[model samples]
Target: MDFQNSLAFAKELDANDPLARYRDEFLYPQVNGKDVIYFTGNSLGLQPKRTKKYVDDVMKDWHELAVEGHFYAEKPWWDYHERLATDLAKVVGAKEKEISVMNTLTVNLHLLMVSFYRPEGKRIKILCEEKAFPSDQYMLQSQARFHGLDPNEVLVEVKKRKGEHFWRTEDILDKINEVGEELALVLMGGVNYYNGQVLDMKTITKAGKEVGAFVGWDLAHGVGNIALELHDWDVDFAAWCSYKYMNSGPGNASGIYVHEHYLGKKDIPRFEGWWGTKKETRFLMQPEFDPIETADAWQLSNPPILSIAPYLASLELFDEVGMEALIDKQKRIVAYLEFILGEIDKQVESTFEIITPKDRGCQLSVFLHGEGRSLFDYLMKNGVITDWREPNVIRLAPAPFYCSYTDMYNFGQILKEGILNK
Candidate 1:
């Protein structure tokens, strides 16, 4: 489809969008009596209109049923987390039994590390991408320290070269082979947070496996933003937060995936909890932990029904829209944004450069050369909800579910005006 940087053309695209009705499903913050062009779905998604009702239903269950809500509520609290597994499996491209909704992203990463990041003897190093999310960096450092190893020596990073903004697949694979003998784990973000570069997870995972290293992914940005095949790619394990593209509210529950090969392996080390025990005999209170036979074995506590409710509501929309339709719209919206930005570049002597790679998701990170934070502030004052990174990058995302093509055109206009005025 050809893209045009005009309001009429943008509206035409919106008119033909099959998922246009979904914009009405969410509530956006108002700016001067109009909805702001929100482009920060890469950070926090807009709230779904049905989220309140979902929360209220859980509140009502607690008020009326109290403790009995565990087993007798409309959707029993005892197994509430289980409700999301099948839908999440479809989103992540895995077997239903291979996925589970559990604790927050980092906590689940730590739990999975206990089972997968087994550094021993000569193979104690961990490989990862450079400039990872701070939380992931801290987790990796602490995990290495837990095994009495120096983080400087144990951690290896795949960095961008001289003037490059992204890592090459061949360089990454070559690094995996170079560190083959000593590498114990290969943990990376499926999509880079700052630049929105979608890494080739399948090839990377295969390279790590060939070197006999455990491979995992932090899919915080990858989960709902991109199409994935964790099972088909033979990923050892993966974890992600629900608040970003999943639109489950801030600090919501997370989802995890473990390959079927590790399903019933009792020998795998994990921090066992009663909730992870086999449900049939869970009430018996057996002294020894008898783990479940699937990915649910990693669960440490009972489901947080209220916190998980919004995710269920959002998941219904995902299931209704489906990945095929969602991605089709995603590509179109991204292409339109690129086209509009390119026109802005040609019209003005702009200092900004789009550093995001071609293989990307909804986000496009703009590097403001020698510019200060004032340009970003101007956009904020003018009602463009984008994310500002330190130094000088503004990350914007036009989420397919809620953002219209007109939003992209307006953002490009505002951005052009801001740059020129500054």
Candidate 2:
């Protein structure tokens, strides 16, 4: 595709986007005086205008009701966590009872591991992608050491074939089949932080269960940007943060999922706290911890109501625009980005390569042929904002809710200047 040819095409696409009006909802960053092309929604989403009001409501409740807010406010603070479940369940395509709004991503992962990683004799192994976020790797290592197992022996890291930035679906499935008997848990990120590849969660979940292995997903980058069916897919457990595509502020509350099939079995050993106890019998001063028959059993402490308010605001917008419509819009934006990138690749004859899958979701990872870090800094010196990974990869994500096709074109133009100017 020709560069000018593709740029013209993109201008038209932006003009006709039905979701274009949605851009008015976010707080775009300003550099000097212009709206810089902010495409790093994978790392941190732009804040929604509704978030301020959502947070103010909580502040008002606390100011007026104090402790009584737990019982007396319009939406009782005691029941605040419950208010988020239905919307959380719908976003992940799971039953309401299976989903619960709770702690941060790494915290929930460790909690889930405590229950699911009961290593018996030869069954004590954790399988994960090598390129997983460092926090996840640390959690796995620490969990294995807590059980007195060598991290090297109990943890298996799946690597991609040579010269590949992303893992192959077939390789991942075949590895599970090959080691099905000894694997205890499959923990991985939904969309890799580096390459922006969207893994096939349903297929992997099925393959893991075939071998009796517990499967879990960390959806920090996947939650709001992609469509999932955790219930129908029979995902054993999953956790995600709302700060990325969910448009919640930094360090906002996260969510968890537990298959309904596991509920009602209160005897199932899990690390629990008073917050997870049955609400009806919770304040009876009972010594025993009786968990509610849902994902709520995983909570170890009372939720931060102030933090959760932002998610409620974002989820309502998500409900307004269903996942199908969102995903369709995302595909179009990503395709437009890929088209522009392809045009750049043609002029330079593959001097820059896109590492993420071409047909994938809302993000792309670009690699410079000459000097990656220098080019990265040059782009940053300009009005473009993208994330750079170690050893030469820069990630750009144009979220559907607010990013414009004009932004994608601007990002490409900035990239060209960075390359040619260098």
Candidate 3:
């Protein structure tokens, strides 16, 4: 689709957009009595208007039904998380049984690692991309230390070439082969958080399996933003937070996917809790853990109904439009955004560069050359919400669910003004 860097063209696109009505579903922050152009959904998603009603339903159950609400509520608290499985599975492209909405992302990562990251004998090293999200880096370092191995020796981070901003797929595949027998686990983000580069998870997974290593993905930025086929990709496991692109509230319960082959394996080591036990016999208080034969087995505790409620509300939206429609809009809007920025670059004497890859999600990380946070502050003051990474990058994520093409045009105008006025 040819894109024009004009408000008329943007409004025309918005008028034709199939997903345009979704913008009203969310509540946007206001600045000077107008809605801010929110492009920071990559960091924290805007709250859906329905989220309050959903959480209120849970609160009503608690107020009237009290303890009996566990079984008697309209949507029973006891199995609240179960209601999300089918819809969540569609968003991430996994079987309903393989997906479970439970703990937060990193917590689920550690739980999955307990079962999948089985480092022994000569295969002790765990491979990940360099500059992974800080939490993941810390988790990998500590997990290696927990296994009585030096993180420096056992944690292998694949680095980009000196001039490259993102990791090349071949480099990752070659590293998997280079490590070969010594690599126990291959864990990386489905999308690089910094540059918004969506990795080729299928190829990476195949490479890891070919080399006898367990492979998993941290889909924190990929789940609702990009089209994923985790089960078909043969990814051993995967985890993602709902708050970012999924537009669930902040720090909401995360979803997980465990391949069916591992579901019934009782011999697999896991930090089991009572919630992991089969629901039928949960009341019997059995001493031995009878794990549910699905991703449900990984759940450590009964989920917080309030937290799950917001996610359920968000998932309903996902189920309505589906990933295919959302992805189409994603491609179009991102292309328009790129086109607008390119036009801005031509008009302004600014030196910023877009570091994000073309094969990416909603986010485009702009490297502000010979400038600093002051320009970012300028965008913020003018109600263009974006995120700033360390050094010189400002990330903008125009989410398809709520962000319109006009928002992209407005962002370009504001960014151009911000650059020119400087």
Candidate 4:
């Protein structure tokens, strides 16, 4: 993990990395004449090299099979949605019947809220972290308004007690009990986007369940990037986009999880369409909605095959190297990153802090205590492609699939120079 001493030391660590072969799987960025050290995986993951084939397979089917592609093409478009369910389930730690690949993240969130957030007279409040993704906040607000309740009255955010960098487990559980019968759902990010802090999802879900509230998660930054056990965790539901850590290009399709126990509850309504109907009876052109039980019942339409193709391609790489192994590799690489960044922090005169939790996934958020934007721009000019969040944070992620220790070492050097020079 001692890759911070010099560029040579960093190169040596990269040489010994077991996951080094994965660096060649995706396209790398170039700034000026050299490859830029990209640390923005938490925002947008690099594209897999096999994406073209994945897209082209669908394209080829469209060209030759034309309308017949729905039933006749290779991997038949008719049942194509089901094909991804098994692997997608593996990605999120759910059973095949508990997962479905469809819809964007925000859309899925709203759909899920419609089915789960049925608040009674006074039991209308939702418990979430205050600084949640804006989409989540907006969805909660809109849902509360739609239910004829003011957001201020119904939405309850679990604030950090006093002034703490992160939320406490006891504080959240206490709030859950304080709200008790009033709480409708407990939803939060699996890992926060800005700070890269992996929240205790299993415990939170259990706490929510204990208080008779549904539980869900937004794993936009967590899926494929960290280890999850939604089935084992007994989570009620969850949604996540594939573009971030799943490495499925920009704005890829997302997936959902529903615990298997819920499949038998026919009374629970869903925003449904033909695609979610049972495959055997779907094309029968029937009238009554005999909803296909299981997670696929949540689907509202046919998947955007073009958008989903790259996800399939990206998933293949993960299937080859299972999530456990990937997570193991991430720990090693991120530990290396933390060791280097920590040492660089000591040499600099300017105040710099790693706001991200030490045990987080590969991503780390650096707080420029004094100079923020100017230093960020300086790093960009020096061939480092990390992104700057508003205020004073630069989120760096040395993704396991494509990043090397040398890449992080180079980034630390440029980042240090950027701070010192500024």
- When superposed on Cα atoms, how far off is each prediction in RMSD? 0.9, 1.8, 0.8, 1.4
lDDT of 1 by residue, 92-130 (tens): 999999998988999999999999999999999999999
Go through the candidates in order and give each one's C-alpha lDDT.
0.92, 0.85, 0.92, 0.85
lDDT of 2 by residue, 392-415 (tens): 878889889988888878777777
lDDT of 1 at 131: 88
Decreasing TM-score order of the candidates: 3, 1, 4, 2
Clashing pairs in 1: none
Selected candidate, larger lDDT, 2 vs 3: 3
lDDT of 4 at 204: 87
For residues 115-146, could you state the per-residue lDDT of candidate 4 as single tens digits? 88898877789999968999999999999999
> What is the alpha-carbon lDDT for the whole of candidate 3?
0.92
C-alpha TM-score for every candidate: 0.98, 0.96, 0.99, 0.97
Give the C-alpha miss distance for residue 125 in model 2, angstroms: 1.2
Colliding pairs, model 3: none
Q: Model 2: which ten-residue window has the lowest total lDDT? A: 1-10
Model 3 residue 9 distance off true place after TM-score fit, in angstroms: 0.8
Alpha-carbon runs more than 4 Å astray in model 2: 1-8, 348-350
Model 4, runs deviating above 4 Å? 1-4
lDDT of 3 by residue, 48-158 (tens): 999999999999999999999999999998888999999988888889999998889999999999998888998999999999999999999999998998999998889
Q: How far does residue 144 in candidate 1 sit from its true spot (Å)?
A: 0.6
- Least accurate stretch of 10 residues (summed lDDT) in model 3? 344-353
